[model samples]
Target: MSPNSTDAMKTNLGEAGAHLKNAATDAGSAIKNAAHVAGDELRMGRSAVKADLADSALAGIAALEEGGGAAREQMDQLMDKGRDLIDSAADLIRERPIASFGAAFAAGWIIAKLARSGDR
Candidate 1:
């Protein structure tokens, strides 16, 4: 090649190298900016997930408390029914003292006889 052509080619190659270097530097900056944006978005998403979990926990606690209240109410009703049964039995016993005593004696005698029979 002639001297002029060689110098021209070297100058062109240098310009191309500079352009490539600029492009690489710009790409690195763009990649760093994208990573920062992604980090910010991830931090916001983490907080959103935590809030959702907290709301779900509160809902679960409310449901459990409601269930507990229902169970307590049912237990109270059962206790009242048991008290009614006891009251009726007491009234019956009071009204029929002699008959209750006779029946008790007969039941004891029968149970003793059956228990002795099993032993024999």
Candidate 2:
């Protein structure tokens, strides 16, 4: 082959190789960008789930707090009733001696029964 023709052919082949290498690099860069986008989407989804769970937990706690407040009010009412009954019995015993003793014995027995029932 002529030297000029050979040199031209070599130059053409070299240009084609450079073009192929550039195309491969571009494809690699595109693949990396797609992977990065997918990773970001996954992280965003996880964050959304975590936020939902946190909101649900907060709602549950609010419900529990409301229930606790209601229970406390009921307990206070029971304690007040118990105190009134005890006070009434003491007043009756102070007003009458023999009758008061019998009533007092009955009250003590009932109180003991209630205490035992609570233990069970």
What overall lDDT goes with each candidate model? 0.97, 0.96
Candidate 1 weakest ten by summed lDDT: 1-10
Query: Tens digits of per-residue lDDT for model 2 on 1-120?
Result: 567988999999999999999999999999999999999999999999999999999999999999999999999999999999999988887888799788779999999999999998
lDDT of 1: 0.97
lDDT of 2: 0.96
Candidate 1 lDDT tens digits, 1-120: 567988999999999999999999999999999999999999999999999999999999999999999999999999999999999988988999999899899999999999999998
lDDT of 2 at 72: 100
Which candidate number has the best TM-score?
1
- On the 0 to 100 scale, the lDDT of residue 68 in model 1 is 99
